[model samples]
Target: MTSTAPAQEWPADVRTLAIDVGGSGFKAAILDPAGAMLTERVRVETPYPCPPERLMSSVVDLTQDLGHRDRVSVGFPGLVRNGKVRNIPSLSRTAYDGDTDPALEDAWRGFDLAGALTEAFGVPTKVANDADVQGCAVVSGEGFEFVMTLGTGVGTALFLDGRLLPHIEGGHAPFRKGDTFEEQLGNVARKQIGNERWARRVVEAITAYDRFLFFDTIHVGGGNAKHLDPADLPHKARIVANTAGIIGGVRLWDLDA
Candidate 1:
């Protein structure tokens, strides 16, 4: 199919909710299909012993507060196939780090997240990987695009032909022999280098990533993107912030089509 650029105006009648779920926190916003934020984005710390029931309940509480949004989009940190989380280890490190919480089980290994949200909210829900959704917000399919997010852990997602594919754990991808990219460039790296030094190193890292991937554009976003200084960047890349949920939510249809 020939791809069109994202619309400047969103469909007016559809009200949608977009949620970002991470290892540590959750961020969400209610928006009109036109991509206008209708309510302030709300965030809460993700519960430590994240049983699926509890996680699902947190979402219910958030939507109930919104009252009547008709559509919902959720961004999960793990590998999502047909709205089901296939790998918890990639999404929640604490759950898989061999510190098995009594509350979790293998049954949750691949649960239908879309159906759960639909059942709870009484509205159709579309779910995609958090990194993939973030990539949708910043990359418009103009060329080869790679997005890197530095948050609780490093996240990587790619966008091609105006479509958001499944996320890649580039952070978990091996970097120097045995160490993963996340270990090198993730926020944990912040402790080793102060913000300024980290920014400089980010510049170097992005330059290397660009050259390696031959990417025409590199888009960076995440909780930590705000802490970076554009002046220290090494290449010509767009620094995007503030509108990640809005732009990313617009691509929620990818879950079905």
Candidate 2:
């Protein structure tokens, strides 16, 4: 049965187990209700052939040292609908043939991630796209806001007047040369084309997205965000800590958030 700790008798400061599942690493930590980390975050390299079962096992192992938590939240690098993963490009063999194990792709598609985590940890669990979760941690909640995460792949999330909009897998949308945003700006692309060229691509992407969305503000995050120079970013954009992934997890349980 699903635990309803957050909606029931859980204390105001109840701890939350926050997991950030990325293409390159799986990280976890304990956070207080206010979204502050209560323990040192731990990370492990994402296992190759990272199907649901293997990913769950790694998450459990990584958080073994963190103390008790009332609930769990996960920020996944994929399309999540009602806690199930619909598409995980970085893990899909069809999308990254050389890096992924083809045999495991189907297992990741349509995986019930929240159900599995609730069963394993015996706590209420919520799952959402990594960028959506990060947006929760930093959005001003005043007007139209956008978030872009630059990591193993690009991720985007939109909010208007503080409410999340229906998710759009814009990262997979074509950006240049008939290639998806991930193909042009993802980590592999940066390595293949060099930082200067990658930075240029990022600038071009920002310009294009501005014209398309016209958001009041855009928060840029993820591991690769650090590689960008502040001066190179647009006036409407600002860099946020990668830790927003972990911190934002708590907001998943906020009914009004």
Candidate 3:
């Protein structure tokens, strides 16, 4: 089920189609090997009960007209390992913010997402945890760099001296008050608490992570990151734009190589 588009000129020899699959939306753009976007990003509202095939179709529709793509890169919001979906917090639910469905959860587990996408798009494909892909674009490759994406739920990635570390669903780890970080700092919390206090909580989360990880630098980026107060951010931390998810797609191949 390939989506076709009129061929457009690409500035670089390799044309990478970057897809950022968020819980709320799916965004896509074409990028040069250098990681600069060649097409304006296209986005679509995410569908509920999105099994693996439905998500892939949506992605194909979202990127069909962006331009010709030589390769596909997906930034999926989940724990992906070796092209398989180990766990996906959002799409496995019966509905957005709804209870999880055991059937849906079973469908998503062990799904060969990258292979399915490669077959659908008829191009080579790679899938990584959304935060890991975002981190690829922002990390300086210095010592102990960490990334936390604040959105539908928290997502995290870590690096050591420029080498990508194994992916961990750190957002699901227990934080304060016996609640996971996602329960406290996710979008719902941000909306309910309002940005001012939410921003403070964000700072607090980073502070707690700093104490635990002792990271040399921490980068925060996501759809909701724009609402944060810059002054509240720690000196060792900085905010990056959500576009990092798309731009980092090109860099992901480099990490693999």
Candidate 4:
């Protein structure tokens, strides 16, 4: 559903809405296209089997009550190709997995999210993987950079040559001891090890990752990121807020084609 309509331009002063969708929760921000927060961020529980219609309606409802905006950017938790979910491998185990949840199944999968959002809001919308969009916000137009989001699951996204590469799915990639990296480094791992141990693991993981990618920089974000004390980290690494979703959403204006 990639649009051929004249590329929509975001108004200089118009506020834009940014959303980051996860399997367990959703976060939204109302801001200028530059990612500046204009209103307090809003979050809602993401019960699995949430029908796409219901989810969209919820967003519309929230925005309508919160106030309307000119653009909407969504960071979805799946492999989005041309604004459609090709495979939701990471989110497949959630409540909506089989579309078995009677309250909402048809609306979750096989829906043209960007298109539906446009129809719902009468404004342009752009969608991408949550981790990918988070990574996009980290790149500083210099060299390769990556982001590892430590939340319900670990998510990794790589940016190369300044353009965002879609659907990297680095979290599911196998790591040591027959476990996926996400399982080892994700929030699940934190719970297994407790906070103090989890922090140590994060340091070691980051050090190894730096060596593996030979990356110029690494950014750590997500809910758990705030818990990480900067003094505990090795070397100089940039730490950013999860709010990158808004800035990355603004980049959609540049991506419209």
Candidate 5:
């Protein structure tokens, strides 16, 4: 996202409900116009076979006790364009480690998540890829910046001079051993391989990513990011807090985030 328009000004009274949808859980919090948390974060375990309707209800349930929200911002794990969903690796599965469900796959295609949430909340809503939303919180507005979020699956986002580039599901791209990045580096892979080996794989993945993109810095976030040891990663790489998903929600309204 790049901005040509002037910055938007939210009235001090506006409260934003920011939701972070992950494979393992759904988390949300109310944010002041300035992005400070206005209420303690609320969370719910994400149910398996989570079709769009179920996911929508989960989001609504999170805000039941948080009072009124002037708008909504969502960080979705799937590929979203124009507020619609595309590929849904996490949500398409029947179980956490199960194979994709064809029925779920068809249901998610072009689902209007932003529109649905807008109507549900009775407010304007914006949705973007989870990694893109997380990247919005961490980028330095310098040269090329990249974010890699390791969760149930992997998520990727890119930015240049503070402007977001288009989204890419880089984790699904080929890596080695006839496996893709998500196949080799996701949470399931980490459990199968152990953190020691997973850390090694992470370094290797970052190295390969650097070779391909040569980012100014690679910020790693998501639930699984804590497993990595900074000493093993390239000097330019840094691990960021998982809370960025919620903290970055306010930026979603900005023209360039």
Candidate 6:
């Protein structure tokens, strides 16, 4: 769904608390209704064995000093459905091998994240996949657009004329050598293989997606985007600011409402 607000009528005084939950970090900021951050963002490293309670506590601590907001919006790095966290891929047991904490991982499954945050912060809240939220900040409202975030893992979002489509876990889909896009292109992979080799994989990823999706434009964002060379990207693809994660949060409320 797309925002109904007219281009010139964006309510300037409406403030929102925008939260971005990633595998490696959690960040929160106060944002103007138009999606620009109004205050310095606060962030903390995501705790390992992040059960729902631990995550919630960290989020609460991160936002404690951000001041008041009329509403809350969250962009989470997982599969969210109807405001609940359906799955947390990066935090799952399979992702950790022997270090896995089954109980903690299970606690995240089906957690009503939006509801919990709303109750804890005393505001209306909305939630969506992190990439879908980022798409809200960057989609140009022309033809088809595809967004990819390469951070702790890969995230994909698609939009048509600025309307976000249903999220697809394309990051988990096989890309090459039986490894998923996340497996081959995430921060872990980049660090493992060195920037030069990782850059090559990113180029390959862009070409592969362009061939299959044929998107008119591709926007790449996330912490790792800074490491990529613009020259290596396709003409249609460009790097976007990491702040898109927080900026896109406000738009999520528009979709939910």
Best by TM-score: 5
Q: Which model, 4 or 5, shows the larger TM-score? A: 5
- Model 1 per-residue lDDT tens digits across residues 76-153: 776767666666543344442235443364646778777787777776677776777777677777767888877766
TM-score of each: 0.84, 0.93, 0.94, 0.84, 0.95, 0.91
- Shift in Å, residue 233, candidate 6: 0.7
Off by over 4 Å in 3: 1-12
lDDT rank order: 3, 5, 2, 6, 4, 1
**Alpha-carbon lDDT, every model:** 0.68, 0.85, 0.87, 0.70, 0.87, 0.83
Off by over 4 Å in 6: 1-12, 93-101
Which is better, 3 or 6, measured by TM-score? Answer: 3
After superposing candidate 1 on the true structure, give the runs of residues whose Cα lies further than 4 Å from its correct spot. 1-11, 89-107, 254-256
Task: For candidate 6, write residues 1-257 as lDDT tens digits.
Answer: 22222223335698889898888889989998778889998989878767788778999889988897877778888888877777777765433322446776688877888778878888667778899999999888899999999998899999998888888888888899999998899887898899999989998999888878999999999999999999888899999999999998877766534
Q: Provide the lowest-lDDT 10-residue window in model 6.
A: 1-10
Pairs of colliding residues, candidate 3: none
- Estimate the TM-score for candidate 6: 0.91
Q: Scored by Cα lDDT, where does model 1 land?
A: 0.68
By summed lDDT, which 10 consecutive residues of candidate 3 come out lowest? 1-10
lDDT of 2 by residue, 1-257 (tens): 11223466579789999999998889999999889999999999888667788888999989988989888888999898866778887876433335665566678877788888888888888888899989989898899999999999999999998888878988888788999888899999999989899988998898888888999999999999988987998899899999999999877677442
TM-score result, candidate 3: 0.94
